[model samples]
Target chain A: MKLLKLIFKNSLRHKLRSSLTIIGIAIAIIAFGLLRTVVTVWNSGVDAASANRLITRQAVSFIFPLPASYRAKIASVPGVKEIGAANWFGGVYKDKSNFFAHMAVDDNYFVVYPEFIVPKDEMEEYKKNRNACIIGSQTAKQYNIKLGDQVVLEGDIYPGRWEFNVKGIYTPRDQNTDATQMLFHYEYLNETMLQQSPGRANSVGWYIVQIEDPNNSASVSKQIDALFMNSTAETKTETEKAFTQGFISASGAIITSMNFMSFAIIGIIMLVLANTMIMAARERTREYAVFKTLGFSAKHLTGLILGESLLISFLGGGVGLFLLYPLIEGFERAMPKGFFPYFYVEPITIILAVTATLLVGVLSSVFPIHRALNTKIVDGFRHVG
Target chain B: MADIIQVNNLSKSYWRNSLEIPVLSELSLNVNEGEFLALMGPSGSGKTTLLNIIAGIDRPTNGSVSVSGTDISKLNESALAKWRSSNVGFVFQFYNLIPVLTAFENVELPLLLTKLNKSERKKHVETALNIVGLGDRIYHYPKQLSGGQEQRVAIARAIVTDPLLLVADEPTGDLDKNSADEILTLMERLNKEFNKTIVMVTHDPHAASRASSLLHLDKGVLSTNGQSH
Candidate 1:
């Protein structure tokens, strides 16, 4: 039999031990993979953010409003290509449980986010009616919404029942695109505010600014914020990536714990596999002595020990990865819609997982290899049994 | 017969907390080609230590051992290992067969070092096992075999490479009388018919009587009074 065959047979020598170690490693890998996927989904927005797009929000916080008149000032900025006024509507559809991002946006908002694919006819229908709204494909699917259908919202922030027609449905341009937001006319909300809370009228939450060149975004953002410097509504401007990153920080602890736990799982994997290997090596001391007597080199013993470790590691890792895809799918389905807009197993996660498993395999074999190579044949024979 | 194995002023010692504990001291010895020589001694007599030195599995603190022509004591660890694979066969006291490997696989271990094809190695393994009267039990694991059968499989492994010398340390020490006689008879036939040289260390006089020549070790040195050739 080949040396590989011997390695394979030796790994199976203690059937229960090998199997248990393999299962433990597999489960740890799955947990690590799941945590990694959560972390990836957590940053999906930042990954999809456009470099040329920038957000100008009140320096105090995103919750505060900017005067609607600032949209014209932002549009006049030297490098600004397109600018739109928008506000966080926070309008609940039916009950508080039916949660989704509802935002009020002017016509140019859609232009700034071209990744939202809206049809020509639907765009015309949406522009024709001030009460018309565009819901993302996922949002449409969740509410079973259709074009020309009236969608009513109980305004939690504005304290009024509002009605709007679904004039268009927009789909995501790519996997990282979030298709879970509902966009309606900012003017419609502004008009209701003017008639009701006059003080909150003619104000937008933020300005969505697109620039001529992404390289000029930093200068343009500085120029936009400088326009309102020392004013009651001082603005903080940054690229969409930074905006999304700031948004992710809202749930920072969860992601931080997941990052910690992912690495913690790797440590655990190394310890479990090392324990199994050390025990096996101890039990096979005399056998290694016999091998030396038969003229097997230290390199051969290393191959046997390292090969068995890698075999078990890869077996566990392979099974864990195979189980991860379905587990993530189930996890995604079990969560409320739009909870994590783009849940995907990124390629880097697989690369890191495979790399970690191989590293752990090599690491676990260190002590065993040293023991095998250092033990004199005579002393090993003395330790028989 | 030419002296196929030679030893000159060999010494082996272990260091315990800066104290010297000698196992073999200034020992000199020789064995002719095709000779089945047995070494008999009491516990702590250093017979096994001497056997290990001759087998290239351990090193001496002083002096040299030459088998056939090469001074094995002068070879580096890796080179000595390679030389042993090509020139020396070993049978251990406990019949140290790999418990995970089948008899066929165990016999194939030494041959794995050779540049032989799978079929060629298989043929050599079968021939060796047949010579040891274990041809039909090639697929059995070491744990599946009785004490005598395991020793036979280890012997099969030892001879499969057709090495120049065989060194067995208490090869039949763990076997019953009938099994011990069978193993000794097999070793004798290998020496007499095939001319395979052997140096065995044993405690039992019955086992030593089966050897064509005999020696005794006392106080870490060879005893000339019990020496016979």
Candidate 2:
């Protein structure tokens, strides 16, 4: 107990240096936490993807479209239980900067994605009218859009000024479910495109196929892709997770760099802590020599040094995490809505943050412990530091 | 009385880029229990080095030092540390108290190696502090105490474990004359009343005068100016 008191006192002996080091460690941990959260959010769609769902898109690229006729053919596959189609209606709502995912979906779309829980009456109302649409709760809250409100969008890809009536607002079934998109009927879009541009009529960006058994997804994907083999819009079918992952992997370098940077923060924290521990050990060389003469064993000396280091690290980590929760909340609020949908710290991020600090604590103490333990009694006394 | 310390043919040296710099030559000494012996020498006379060897804080290049019939020089690092903890205590010139600890905590340091509980350790610490005339100042940090008071706290720390011998290297080297006199008087009482075996190294003849016997060293060897009172 007395020894522990000494360790605590020794760590705070230089208040300014210790405080600065702790602050440095804390800031580094915060940076690490934020970056890891971002990486988690980037891959969140893939993690939330349904295992029983398969996506069939143009093999050449997602930008290319597949015939809407492919849907009936895909639904006939033995394992296919249901099928839905969506066309990416890239459009500007109010302003280009006020961005959100907008898609035109077939009537059976909600049946495949059960995580989007829309009111049955609202969904029926949306399906009854040709110009009715459903916006997610996040989008409704972001834009103040309500039922029976009018939503006007200038289409960039389809190239037209379009308008629709908001018929319903869909909320997420769970936290991981995306509530940042707007969904409308593909029939309205197809009827317009059929007259405006015959080449783009009755086509969809992707087809979502629901299978009877999730385990058969590989075979089901192969069979769907084989049906469209050597055709103009060759289909590449895969599990919903892989399809979502394919989009995430398009920014693979950025996520990879972010992953690298998060660990780099851990490395920076280690360096800061190691520097502090080393300086503290150096300053106490004579004191350690006195301890040696007082008959302190190597174990005792090690305890003193390591105890002080770990105490400092744990303190920093605690403060960092304490500040992180509110900081993440404010960060999410400050970000443009739907910019990073579901931007919350994952449990794995917290675990890694804690484990990183612990590792830094032990690693930072290594050189200092070795130095203190190896110093001869006479030499330690002679050390000016 | 039994000889509490035995030093036989002790030597110490170090190397400076392969050039051996000898600090002490083969020397022999012995002191009985309860004897207060002062080692006085000029600068570079190796009095401190000799004191360090007898205290078992430093190893001799050759020969052995035995305390209570145990050859301390033969012990390994940890064994030597264990032997020193129970057998030897050291008082430094600078009072080397851990500045972060209170006077009471500083004195309790050596006894931490013992199996004494907190209250037992506290009791022992208070007694040692009272013996050094600092009982009322146990809660004071080294920075809050006078130079003489700090040295007293150091003496308390040294004796707290009740070691077999108390070795001091220039104990009054950093004190004013009045503080030095008080320290010498306390040592006198500890030797006369407590029957402690003490070996002190100093350059001051005045400090050496308080010892029952005196020896002078020159060039790492004891000179013939040694005498007993």
- Alpha-carbon local distance difference test for all models: 0.91, 0.90
Q: What docking grade applies to model 2?
A: medium
lDDT of 1 by residue, A231-250 (tens): 99999999999999999897
TM-score of each: 0.95, 0.93
Best by lDDT: 1
Cα lDDT tens digits for candidate 2, B105-188: 899998888999989998999999999999999999999999999999999988898887999999999999999999999989
Supply every candidate's count of residue pairs whose N, Cα or C atoms clash at under 3 angstroms.
0, 0
Candidate 1 lDDT by residue in tens digits, B145-176:
99999999989988888899999999989999
Candidate 2: which pairs clash?
none
Q: Give stretches of model 1 more than 4 Å off.
A: A142-150, A195-198, B224-229
Which 10-residue window in model 2 chain B sums to the lowest lDDT?
A: B220-229
> What's the distance in Å from true for residue B76, model 1?
0.6
TM-score of chain A of 1: 0.93
